[model samples]
Target: MTPTQIGLVGLVALFVLLALRMPVGLTMMGVGLVGFAALSGWGPALAILGREPFVIASNYELIVIPLFVLMGNFATVSGMSRDLYGAAYAWFGHWRGGLASATITACAGFAALSGSSVAAAVTMGRVALPEMRRYQYDPRLATGCIAAGGTLGILIPPSTGFVLYAILTEESIGRLFLAGVVPGLLLTALFIVAIYLQTRLYPELGPAGAPTPWRDRLRVTGQASSMIGIVVLTIGGIYAGLFTPTEAAGIGAFLAFCLAVARGRLAWSGISSLMLRSIRTTGFVFLILIGAHIFNPFMARTHIPSDLAELLVGLDLPRLAVLGIVLAAYMILGTFLEGFAMLVLTLPIVHPLILALDFDPVWFGVVMVIVLEMGLISPPVGVNVFVVKGIAEDVPMRQIFAGILPFWLAMAVGLLLLIAFPGIALFLPNTMIR
Candidate 1:
């Protein structure tokens, strides 16, 4: 059979395995390795299978993943997540749906540190859920907000999603991280607005709490300042060109470790256990990267990505129209596909079409990350929704999804705003210091 036919078979097999719930990295590696052997013979394919893991492992820039993840784990062990949540709640917990809004605020803050949506959801949910419950916040709204808020992890700085996107496209990770800032803030604000409007429409959903005294609020904020300071120094340093992203990640990790030690929340004896978990997560990310690298070349040989781009560009649709089609396709794929798998599988095809349409890569990267965020809360495969359910198991799954609807709509609005004003994403990146 021709290479195209083999590629087509591989695609079909990949989806079938995914349907059977095979892990994304192994599935991609298997299909790509076998498909390439079909086209280029077993010797070269076997060499790649043996060689590519070392290549991916040795990538210096990729150290950012493990370092950033370790930073998050340290922050968690330090009880910094609770401090951030407490500060946000001190400020916002009195407003109607204020508890939910505070969850978003806290999640955004933690997302800046953790860069993992699952970590944000789990960490915030553990602290905020019982409070929201005690205040009698609607289960749907309480759980929904956590699930939706956690997605900020991927759209904010130090995001693993941005790192993966940058690696796949060879774009600047710093630029992509900077690009996400304004939009991430915008989306966070929109989520707050959604909470305010929702509770306004149905006051019972989130009753107001007794307001905290100004002195207490100030005290809580002071307590949380350390977390705020660390994020600013790390992400801000990267933005100012004071250091590379890798260096920022390393600094953040050390600061987080020191904070945990100072707080007596993490024991020296537990260091090995913490390192093992971080290494495991880092290894998983590397496996995905390796799979994408192997699969990308095989897809290139099949010419599917080029053919699709040529066909789409050949149609001469308005660039916005083309972009709309691409995003719409993302929404559909996000319904069932896991976000990481969906990303590596499709970027080889979509990234070129995006460039061919003349969209700014940084801008598109930000836009794409938002789409991925939407997928995180989308039905069936909304991973963050599942995270919320695990935390609030007493809350029904449908209610969690119900709560996500408003935040999801808010996300749509944020997406539209970014598209209408590309500068929202491009401004900071464009202004980066030399």
Candidate 2:
């Protein structure tokens, strides 16, 4: 049989395995290994199994993953997320739907430290939901904002999603991180504005809280100021050419550890737990990379990427039209696939197609991450929606999905803006001090 046919069969098997609830990493590794052995021989396929795990494990750029995860754990234990929420609430809590706005703001801040959507959603939800409830805010608005806001974890700096994208595409992690800054902040602002507008139209959906005294505002801001500085020092240092992504992650983790210690927050048992979680998270990311490494080689041997790229270019469609079609398919796939798994599974093909279309990889990285996260909150299987529902158990699943609509729309609007004006993502990366 032809190699392309073999690749197609492998993809079908991939879906069947996934449907059977096999782990994504193992499924790809198994398919890739079998496909490669079939096309080339047992010797080379076994050699790959022996080599790729060490390669992915020892990758220097990837050390950033565990460091950032550890930083997030330390920051969580330090109560920094709560402090950030408190500070935002002190400033914006008086407006209708203000608590929801604060949740978005704080999630953006926490995303820098956590680099994870589930962490952002769960942490911010625990911190913000009770207060929103106390203020009689609409459950839909409360839950929706957290779910949507939490997705910022992937769009903001130190994003695991972006890191995986950069590695897959051989793009610069620093550039991708900077490229995300404008779009991430823009989406955060759009989410806040969407909530306020909704509240303006229906006041009872989110009632205004009493205004905070300036002193209280100053106090909470002081409480969160150190963590904010740590975020700035890490992400900003990268833009200033003073730190590599790995260096920044290391420094951030050290500072988080220091802060946790200073606050007396990390007992010996908690410290051990934190390290174990970081190691597991890092292992999870690395395992997927190893799988993608194996799978990519097998796909390359099949020549499917080159063939598909040629076929698409031959279609003579307008570049944007082709781009739209690609993104549309990604949206459908991402609705069901976990973002990172889907990202790795496709970039072997999509990156070449994107490069063929003459789109900037850095800008496309930013746009792609946004689209991936949108699917996370979109209907039928909104992962983030379910995450929020998990936190707010009293709220119906349908209500949580309904709540996500505006924030999801806000994300769509933000995606469109980034698409129309690519510089929104590219400007920071393009003009980096280095």
Candidate 3:
């Protein structure tokens, strides 16, 4: 059979395996290896299996993934997330829907440190949910804020989503990180507005907490300062060309470790467990990267990307129209597929079309990460929803989903604004000190 036909069959088989609950990394590797062997030979296929893992594992750029992840893990144990939530609560907790606004604010702050939606959601849920419950906030608004706000983890600077996208597209990680700054802040503001409007429309949804005294607000703000400081030093240092993304990550990790130790939270046993979790997360991400490496070459050999790129260009559609179509596909796939899975699967095809359409890679990375964040809260496979549900066991799963709708629409508005003003994503990257 033709290489293209074989590639198509392999793609179909990969999806079937994924549907059967096989791991994404394994499914991609299996399909890629077999497809390559069919089109080339067993020797070349096996050679890839031998070589790609080491190449991906040792990739210097990828070191940022684990370092940032460890920083997040350490930060979690340091009680930084709680401090951030406390600071937000001190400032915003007195407003209508204030706790929910504080949850979004805290999530955005923690997102800078965590680089993980699940971690942000789980961490903030633990810290914020009980407080919201104490104030008798509507369960829907409380759960929704946690789930939706968690998504900021992947859109803010130091984002895992942008990191992976940069690696996949061979773009500058620093540029992509900077590109996300404005859009991330924009979305955070949008979420806050969504909560405010919802509370206004339905007064019972979010009742205000007791107002904080100036001294208490200042104290909590000081408590959370180190976490925010670290984020600026790491992400800002990259933009200033003071450090590479990897070095920034290392520095962030070291600072988080020091903070945790200083806080007396880094017990020997806890440190060991945190390290192991970091290692596992690092390993999982590396496996997906390796699998994508294998699958990418196989797809290249099949000319699938080229064929699709040519087809899109030939259609002569408006550039924005083509871009919209690609994003829509991502949205649809995100409902069922995990973000990383969608990234590795679609980027090979989508990146080429993006370049062909003359879109900025960094801008597209921001846009893509936003869409992935939506998937994290989108129904059916909404990973963030489940994470929040795990925390609020008394709250039904459907309520969490329903709660997210307003925030989900908020995200959609954010996406449109980013598209309408691409500079929102590009401004920081373009004006980088470097």
Candidate 4:
């Protein structure tokens, strides 16, 4: 078969495996190895399978993944997520719909530590849901806030999404992290506004809480100081050129471990659990990366990216129009595909197109992450929504989906703002010291 036919058949097989509930990493690996062997030779395919995994796994840069995952696991165990929620609640709980707003605020703070959306949602849901319920907030609004807020994990600094994007596209990790800052904050603010408007129009959705005194608010914020400090030092260190991203991850993980021990939350058993969890998650990420690497060569041989780019450029559409179409495709895929799966599947094709258009890679990474965030809340495969539902089992699934609609629209608005003013994603990256 011709190279195009081989690539096409491999993709079809990959999709079939995905539909059969096969792990994405294995599916991609299987299809890629077969396609490569068909196009090149089994010997070359075997050579890649032997060397690629080690090359991808041993790269010092990828150490950031497990270390950051460890940091997040430690933070979860130490109850920093609860502290964040309490502080946000202290600040926002008194307003109408304040609890929901507070949930978003807490999610943003926690996102700085935890790079995984499901982790952010599950942790915040535990801390915020009970409080929202106690305050008589509408279940839909409460749950919606958690689902939407959790997506900040991908857009905030220390984000795994950005890490993966940086690795895949050969962009600077520091630049991508910096790029996400303003956009992450923008999305968080948009989510807060959505909550306020939702409550304003229907005050019954989120009842106000008893106001906390200033002293009490200060004390709650103080309780979260360790977590806040770690975030500042870790991301700040990278921005200031004091640490590489990998070094920052190590420092962050070490400090998180220290914080957990200091808080008396780190028993030997708990440490073991954190290690195991981080290792497992790291293995999963590494597998996905390996699969993408294997598939990338097969794709390169097929000339699909060039063909697609040529086709796109030949259309003579405005650059902005082309970008809109790409983003729209992501939004649709986000509704059905897992975020990482979508990234591994599309980045080889999309990233080249992005460069062909002369768009900034860092800016595109931020935009891609934001679109992925939207997918985390989109229906059918809305991972964050399902996470919230697991925590709020008494709430109907449909209600959780309904509740996320406003926040979803908020994400849409955030996307448009970033598009119109690319500065939102570029300002920090552009200011980078190097």
Candidate 5:
């Protein structure tokens, strides 16, 4: 069979396995192993498999994944999320729809520490949903805010998705982390605006509650000093060249652990639990990385990516038009695929095309992240939505979806702004790196 036919068949098998609810890492590995054997015989396939694992496992940069995951686990177990929510609530809770806004803000702050969307959604759901419900905020709006806002995890610094993208594309982890800052803040701002407008347009949706005193608000902010310190030590250390990305992860993990222990939240049992969870997640991610390494070389040998790039360039489409089409494809893929899964599946094809087009990789990375962010809020298989639902089973799923609608629109606006001004993503990376 032609290599094209083999690649196509492998992809079909992948989707079939995914539909059967097979773990993503297993599906990719299964199809990739078989495809490699078919194309180059079992002996060569085994040789590739033998070497691939060590090659992937030994990379210095990959160390950041487990460290960052450990940091997030420690932060969650330490109860920093609750403090973040309280501070945001104190500052914003008096305004109409202020509770919902606080939820989004809290999610953003929590995202700084826990860079997984599911983690952010579930944690914020438990912390903020009860408060929103207590204040008679619309259940849909309250739950929806947590679900959509949680997606900030991937766009914010320390994000696993950003880390994975940097690894795959051979981009600087520090620069990629820097690239996300503006876009992440812009999306967060957009979410806040959406919440404000929603409540203003229909004040009945989010009733105003008693306002916190200025002194109390200041006190709440002061209590959040630890979080500020963590952010400074972790992100600031990287940008200032005080630490490599791996070292930054180590600093983050150590600091989170120390903070948790200082707060009396890190018992031996809790530490054991956090370690177990981080190991499980790290194992899964590493397995998927191994599978992609096996599959990517085979795909490159097939010339499919090159062929696609040639076809695209030959079409003579405007560069912006081509970019639009790619963004649309990511939006559609986001609905059904996990963010990491989508990245692994498409980057082989998309990255080559993007490089051939001479577009800025940093800008492209930010665009991809924003589009995936939309997927986190999309319907049917939106992972963040499911996370919130898991935490607040009493809230109807329809209302959760409805509540995210405006935020989704705001994300769309943010996407357009980034596309029009790639400078937003590039400015920090260029200015700081130089």
Candidate 6:
């Protein structure tokens, strides 16, 4: 069979495995290993397996992944999320849909510290969901806000997704992290606006809660200073070249631990649990990385990415049309695939195709992230939505999905903004790095 045909068959098998609910890492590795052995002799495939593990593990850039994950886990156990949400609620509690807006704000802030969407969603769901429910906030809005807002964890700095994208595409991790800032903030703003607009159009959707006393609000603000300090020290330190991304992560983890202890939130038992969870999460991530190392080279051997690039260029389609097609594919795959799976599966092919077309890599990364963010909230297997659903199980799944529609629309708007003004993504990275 032609290499193209072989690649197609491999992809179909991969999808079939995924349909059977196999782990994504295993699916990619399984398909790639079998296909590589079929394409080349068994010797070359065996040789790849022998060498690739060391290569993947030795990659200096990859260290950032576990460091960031560890930092997030540390922040979660430290009880920082509660203080951040309290501050947000105090400031915004009086406005209609204020609790929902506050939830988004708090999620964004917590994301700055946590950088894992699942962590952010699960953490904030614990902190914010009950409060909103207590205030009789709209179930749809309350749950949707947490789900949608948690996505910011990936787009904002310290993002595990950004780190993976950087390592895969060979882009500078620092610049990609910086590029995400404006887009992340814009999406956060868009989410906030959507919440307000929803409440305005249907006041019944979010009844105003009791106003927070000014004195109490000031006190909450004081409690949030630790979070502010950590954000500045970590993100600011990275941007200013005071520390590498990994160093910043380590510093953030240390500070979070200290703060947790200072606040008396962490017991010896809690520390042990946090360490175990972080190690387990890190192990899962490393396994996926190893799988990607094995899988990516096999796809490369097929010449599929180059062929697709040539085919697209030969068609003479408008750049926008090609981009639309790519984005549409992400949306579909995202319904069933997790973000990391989507990136690993596609980047091996897509990155080369995108580079061949002469699109800016940084801009393309931002666009890809936005598309993946949509997948996080998209139905059937939206991870963030499920995280929220798990939190608010009393609320029907359909209602939560319904609540997410406007936020999805807001995300569409954010995507358009990035597409129209690539500078929104490029400007910060260019100014900071160059």
lDDT tens digits, residues 331-416, model 3? 99999999999999989888988998899888889999999999999979999998998999999988899999999999999999
Which residue runs of candidate 4 sit more than 4 Å off their true CA positions?
A: none
Decide which is better by TM-score, 2 or 6.
Answer: 2
Q: How close is candidate 6 to the true structure, as a TM-score?
A: 0.97
Model 5 residue runs over 4 Å out of place are none
Tens-digit lDDT track for model 6 on 68-101? 7777776776777888888988988889999998
Expressed as tens digits, the lDDT of each residue in 165-276 for candidate 1 is 9999999999999999999999999999999999999999999998989999999999899999999999799889999999999999999999999998898788999999
Alpha carbon lDDT at 177, candidate 6 = 86
Q: Estimate each model's TM-score.
A: 0.99, 0.99, 0.99, 0.99, 0.98, 0.97
lDDT of 1 at 88: 93
Off by over 4 Å in 1: none
Query: Roughly what TM-score does model 1 have, to 2 decimal places?
Result: 0.99
Against the reference, the lDDT scores of all candidates come to 0.92, 0.92, 0.92, 0.91, 0.86, 0.87
Residue pair clashes in candidate 2: none
lDDT (C-alpha) at residue 426 in model 2: 92
Question: In angstroms, how far off is 415's CA in candidate 3?
Answer: 0.6
Deviation (Å) of 386 in candidate 3: 1.1
Worst lDDT run of 10 residues, candidate 2, spans: 378-387
Candidate 6: where is the Cα deviation over 4 Å?
A: none
| Candidate 4: tens digits of C-alpha lDDT, residues 156-240 | 9889889889888999989999899889899999999998899889999998889999999999999999999999999888888
Q: What's the true lDDT of residue 234 in model 5?
A: 83
> Which is superior by TM-score, 5 or 6?
5
